[model samples]
Target chain A: MSPRGRRPAGSPDAREAILAAARTAFARDGYRTSLRGVARGAGVDPALVHHYFRDRAELFAEAVVASAAGTGAVDISERAQAISRLAPEELGEGIVRSFVGLWDGLGGDRFSAVIRAAMSNDESLAPFRDFIVTGILGNIMDKLAPDRPELRGQLIAGQLIGFGVVRWLARLDEVASLDIEEAVALIAPTIQRYATGELPSSAA
Target chain B: MSPRGRRPAGSPDAREAILAAARTAFARDGYRTSLRGVARGAGVDPALVHHYFRDRAELFAEAVVASAAGTGAVDISERAQAISRLAPEELGEGIVRSFVGLWDGLGGDRFSAVIRAAMSNDESLAPFRDFIVTGILGNIMDKLAPDRPELRGQLIAGQLIGFGVVRWLARLDEVASLDIEEAVALIAPTIQRYATGELPSSAA
Candidate 1:
């Protein structure tokens, strides 16, 4: 059911308020927290949340993206629409752009926090893991070569994700502060390698 | 100039006391918290801490790795040894073992707290960033083709590291509960592709 199926007294503003509150609450508490909790935090009725958001996933996504208010980075939820831009040669930068943009933009903290939490606590994200692997990362892989394209995409995705963890999450000075181009320069080659690298005999 | 160099009398368990205090202090106040304050918390003179540890880096690493009174994970200075095992293929599992063993073996909350704190704050991990990149990750790359190994290591490392963040820090469901073999099976291939895959033509 929608958290707020119809706008209450203060339509969009209240919805925005609930979304903002959901971002902070989700950022701090995660996706499992009750609608009541969000309502309380937003100073609205729990039903109001349902009216606006279809459910927690929708709310969570909105909160995840909305929380990432300022960073001009790419947003993953917005990725499907971006599929047209996914060329093989430009793949490395495209991969980096999506991830870097996500964190650099608005949802870095919430997204990382949620993802990190999901990694450790098996209860919350059990259902979504395969989807992420086969869906998002895999989708990128399918665009390349079946034999190695997915592996390559994963490699590229892996490194950029690591760079984000160090710079954005772990606050490693070199990574966190490294200029974008320098980082891209350093990171893109790996992406290029993964995007189109030959397999090791051992692996083959 | 060791914090333990000058132990004050009346603190017979000064060493243990210092570690306990350091963990609490770091968790509560993070890396910026004063060693003197930690000493005060442990009811010992700051000199006693200096006597045991050379400085905050030494202390943080110690505190970061602490297991219990007499048994911490391993000495902070000793962890540099883990870096030596970082081969291209071995990097992911090795780091996985290092961190998982540390936390699991210690069976304490200290490292998690430090990881959480360091992730959000850069200054807290100034000493570890290089260790993470050059010492640990780069060493692994050294085992690969030099031309693009760093990029490779970084990508694979990101996935593994992010996996850790998700499993350990974010406490995400599906990943955290994954058995070691299952995790390695799932994660290692991606790691391998990055380590030894052919360089994409665009990359060179």
Candidate 2:
């Protein structure tokens, strides 16, 4: 009705502008922010937002994934590359510090919204799994743990995602309120163990 | 109105019967199973179900918490006691095997229902945090990692709870179909690290 977006429907700028606005709104107001508000901010109609994204979850996934790519926030390949550079013994701390940095730095707000949306329900969670879990996390695991990478990768993802949920979404006071460096200091070793450690032998 | 649950409103038997029925229904049909169906199974009016619980989420919390107590599934105190008896080196495998057993045995069905219900929304997740996180996991951490117990306990809980969600609720085929022993074999060391491992030094 209001002449659509500034650019055409299929144009990259229109789509990118909507996503940029979505990223800002979601970061500012979290997963509960409305498409209408995002549309107004992007100077597009609410219908255009729906046209670009199948639903709120898809929009959110695209926005978070794009932000991660653009800023290299929680970018799996980069993290894996950095961790690979460390001595094998140092991988644990390296991984932990990087994870804490991604969630506690400038990208923290956006990543929190992504995590919150991922944990909100099954529909929202599916895209997160497809994009982040099988994509980013899988890539990291494959690079680090050659054996049982899928299982171990999932274990790492569970730990990190659960951490995000507890620390950010549920706002568990102690874990949530931790200083970023303190959290990195506390949680890194556990990540290290999961990343590269021997499982205990069974007592036959 | 059908004799009001074989005693009175405040009777333990009435409450127990209702919980038993709710547990059965939840196990059979999961979170989407209706309160009306639970009442029908319990041989009481739907109103009686309301008398005992504030809503679906509250009933689900009570049922799952009671199930954990009754079956000792995810009962942190019992797990801590069991782990304490093991050699420190064996603690990792010990915790993993026990956790695998609890979630993969017959109790797995009930526990899956609980996890699914817990993830359904915030209202449903509270009692899970209070009972399981604070009560069971906190006890385990106190017995094992006395320093920074809360963070470590939560990290462990996150890993395990996330495992449950991925394996059961989301039914990620590979993770879900894993043999109980195999899962224990793979996940134990990570748990052990969180339970009693050294945090990395933050190089100034």
Candidate 3:
């Protein structure tokens, strides 16, 4: 019923306002912020959210990328370009620093909500995860090693986020709370090993 | 009063039985299953689950380990001993198979409960994640090349679980429904690469 977003059903132009609002709400409040919150933030009625998003989950997927993009975090195509210039170790640091910096600067409140929602249920989380791994992580993967990038990228990608989960999300006493300096010293070497170590001799 | 269980407090042995029942019931019905379910399954009064576990979350930790031990799958210590003997690529499959074997067979119902509980929130999930990373994954790390085993192990551990998550939990279209052999074949190469691949020279 809001005047700013009365886009008719199936109209591409109309959904943009809803998406913008959804992203703002999600980034501000996190992925689990209610649809009503998003609608209110957008200045549109909650009905418009359903009209464009079909559900809260879809809106959440929109919000993660949008927030990532807005925060200037480096998972974007730009990160790949920057990553290309660094050594393997530097690359790992660049990736880690950028993500951690973004999350840190962004205030963990938003991220915690996103992570909690993502980890909330398998079904609720999958779409957002797929978009990241495929759209965002996949792009990073493409840049890791052009020859057999899939496997190698996957390895790097796994660690990139996995460490984040352990340190930031899980907050294990020793590993989670490590100062960035200590964390960098500890994990960077390990990542370096992962980035350039010799292949193990067997596949099975 | 049932002979199946002992006194509430100071009875270390009785707590273990309650834990065993909790694991089975949680696995069978997930969050929906109540303390009553655990108690009933254990053949003891509901008070005991609270007495020993403090609540479902505490019970969950005990249940998780007890169920795994109950299943006799992956025999953590034995697997720890054998890790060094394993070909690194094979490591992923072995871990995956161990997880799937437990979920699909012995603790299928119970592990599902554990997984569902993990989906809830950080407080309930942190210990579970830590146990897996510090316990299950850490055990495997011991088998890795010692130089950077923690990093390498973490990387491998994340990817393997990520793969399993896609294949099993999230059940994404591209990955979830694959035949076991096909899934293994598709995923193993990536796992192998991560377990032991030289880092790409970032084209700086």
Candidate 4:
């Protein structure tokens, strides 16, 4: 085996390095990025990258999730746990604050990179969408909503994703320029309602 | 002048054709798309494309706005006018219905194309963002909102844009699968609140 592939598949450091490299690669190249390039960036052999990830889609999903989790900052499970613990009334603000905080910390360029990569094609889009809908939003709604948690979670995800797209990706001036606190205040109630409020009569 | 460039710069049909072709080209090639390609697609000379649009960025912005307006359906200004005429209580539902109707009419692939083009780069992003923030959302807020119309408009835009992104672009299963009425029913109240309700004390 080549020295680059000599690292054990079980090595956490090698795995993490590959993910980090994948994030950078996806950000730079979007959906069309190749596994071989990712391996080169990580200084690992192509075989090692394949051994670590079943395919580019898996790597892209995990990289994006890792990036969303803020890499070395706060673990995603911890963040989800924190959100799950919020009182129903506070859920909106908690969710908004947590997402804004993470996005802000990740910085605009990195956040936009993830969005651009996700927008590139269907293959890339599915995993990213799944992560947002199922992994983050659904996980929260499952814990807190009284009815149709799946739908409710998707609704909340839509709002939050819109906020991120407007503020970070699209960089719409009004919302993008707002103080984070102000933004949270403006958006939280809507989120709170989605989390624990009533739906339209027909919807209910 | 060559036959392609011979069409008077004042011809409305030529301008519309160029805009349509620009939309297709941008959707295919994104931010880096060349004006020459758009001209070719429209069967016009590059100079004529420049005559109608100052540059590529302007072409991108106009194409996206044209797409958002729903090429053959209700003109954007008419839709905005209809929204403007709504009573305050009906604003949220009206806004949601209008957007969903337009998006539904435009179909998923076209909507995704505009989004993907917008997400491609900053040069392409600004004009699209301005249209949503200033042109569509801001125009509606200015007519009806009592205070901080710009901010209120943005908030509403965020929700609507999020709805479109989740439903059309990302195609999240829960939200994407929703019938138009159900999706609107779930989201309209929040938009209405943004349009007319009191914001958080600090925000106000």
When just chain B is superposed on the true chain B, each candidate scores a TM-score of: 0.57, 0.61, 0.55, 0.69
Model 4 TM-score, all chains together? 0.74
TM-score per candidate, in order? 0.55, 0.61, 0.52, 0.74
> Total backbone clashes of model 1?
55
Candidate with the greatest DockQ versus the true structure? 4
Give the share of true interchain contacts found in each model.
0.22, 0.34, 0.12, 0.83
lDDT of 1 by residue, B80-134 (tens): 3554555555755555555555555554244445454454344445434544555
lDDT: worst 10-residue window of model 1 chain A: A65-74
- Pick by TM-score: 1 or 2, better one: 2
Query: What is candidate 3's DockQ?
Result: 0.13
Query: In Å, what is the interface RMSD of model 1?
Result: 6.3
Model 4 per-residue lDDT tens digits across residues B1-204: 346444465666878788888777765665556778877777776788878665454565567655653454335555776787888888888888888887787787667777786678887776566556544665477554577777778778788878888889888777888888997898888888888887777777
Off by over 4 Å in 4: A1-12, A15-62, A65-74, B1-74
Q: What is the lDDT, from 0 to 100, of the residue A113 in candidate 3?
A: 55
Rank order by DockQ, top first?
A: 4, 2, 1, 3
Model 4 chain B: lowest-lDDT 10 consecutive positions: B68-77
Task: Report i-RMS for every model.
Answer: 6.3, 3.8, 6.7, 1.4
From the highest lDDT down, the ranking of the candidates is 4, 2, 1, 3
DockQ of 4: 0.57
User: What is the per-residue lDDT of model 3 for residues B1-204, given as tens digits with 9 covering 90 to 100?
Assistant: 436553544565667677777666655565346778777776667777776654444455456644533543234434444554677657756655554444445433444344455635655555566555555556566555445455555555555545544444544454443445544554455455445554323200
Candidate 3 lDDT tens digits, A106-176: 65544555555555555556555555556545545544544445445444554555556555555444444
Off-target runs (Cα >4 Å) in candidate 1 are A1-74, A80-85, A105-131, A148-157, A201-204, B1-12, B25-58, B67-71, B74-76, B81-160, B166-204
